[model samples]
Target: MKTILIPVDFSDTNTNAIKYAADMGCDMPVKKIILLKSYYTSVYEQILPSPDFLLISADDIENERQKIEVQLKELMKKLKNRCHENIEIETVVSTEPIVRAIHNVVEDQHPDLMIVGGDMGHELSMIGEQIIEIAKSSPVKVLVIPPDCNYHKIEQALVPCDLEAVARLGVLKGLNTSHSWLNPKLMLLYVDPKKKHIGREAEFEASVKQLVNCYECKLHYSEDKNIVRGILNFATEQQVQLIIALPGKHSFFYNLTHSSITEALSLNARHPVLILK
Candidate 1:
């Protein structure tokens, strides 16, 4: 049974992500759906100069906590009803920093995949940072659903590979698990560095073929001048719905700072990009 972790903050975007997950899980053998909510205590209020802080009793905090709990239960019920199935929905409430809380949950739950809503603006919110941090730290795959994305049709997926990382069973499992929703046409695109000789084409083909055997999806390969350009061009030509890529381990910090190839593709391509660690 595949487990999917979705962090919720009661925002409409997060709610949409929950709906998307349920819709996708309908045809898959999902074991559990985790909805995590993190709340911070009023440490800032305590430090504030306002004397009104003394007027608020401990009961006020407890009451707020209870309210959030009830809200989560109601949200779970609504989700179950919407999915029309008793997809196991679990909720966690934490006061830790959102990023730390997410990291802790991923560490403990070990979910197969994570789905989060992306912020459309230029600035990253707490939720956005949590999503990005989880994507970087998570051992599994992460999918950030854009605000207006249509989740029903993820038929064509483009995966750009440098063929550096050794493709493992865990990575293959992530791709196969997505097949339930996507039924994707997999494209393994490689960008030939300008200085390298074109004769290495045979070696690249053999490597890609080995990776292709790991899944049953249709595979295509292309050698382009630029990695990002190749991904965008192919996705545009094929009209793909998602792009999957392995983020390189080297210069992890740099990748996160600069818009990654996957990130760039997500912005420019006609589809979403799933970045797997």
Candidate 2:
């Protein structure tokens, strides 16, 4: 049984992600699906000289919260009806900030993965920022589905590993879990730093082979001057549909929260990228 956390704002994008997950669950094992909604009081609006705030009391907030819960219940019911198997659903209401709310939920629940929806362009820049924050801080893996993407059987998964750190069993466990649904063709890509000698490439290949032997997948290596450019180029050339990345010990998150590898992949890559922590 696997637990997946999905944060919803009642947007079509988020709902689409929900549908994708529900459909994917048809071939996989999902124990519980967590639906989270974060609500905040409009402090700025309260300061305004308006009648709207005056008419609204604590009771009004409670009533609205109750309404949202009812709507969520109906949505979950619809999801269950459409899914291939029965899945437990849990709903949460929070008044904390969005970033904080997500962190708190993950800490308390410790879900196996977190799924989110992305909207491109300037209108969604702030939403993108929040998603990036979640990706950086989340202790588990995070999957961001683009708005225009149709849920296809994920047949090929491109994993761009630099071979800089020892692969962890936990990370491999999560990857295998995704395999249950997509049964994807795993490509372990290693982009060697341009300064390194050719001999070092052989050593890296051996390490990757040993790490991935337990899992069923193919492996490939390439030398490139830039890490991000190498990954994007390979993904485009191979027509890869999804990319998976494991945040290394000295990952971009160490220096800045928003500059994580997953964030970079989201901003640049054409395919969806899954960030496994």
Candidate with best lDDT: 2
Candidate 2 residue-wise lDDT, 90-142, digit = tens: 88888777678888998899887888877554344334547767776777788
- The CA-based lDDT of model 1 is what? 0.65
Q: Top TM-score: which candidate number?
A: 2
lDDT of 1 by residue, 65-99 (tens): 79989999999998788663657888989877666
TM-score of 1: 0.78
Window of ten residues with lowest summed lDDT in model 1: 249-258
RMSD of each: 4.1, 3.8
Clashing pairs in 2: none
TM-scores for every candidate against the unseen true structure: 0.78, 0.79
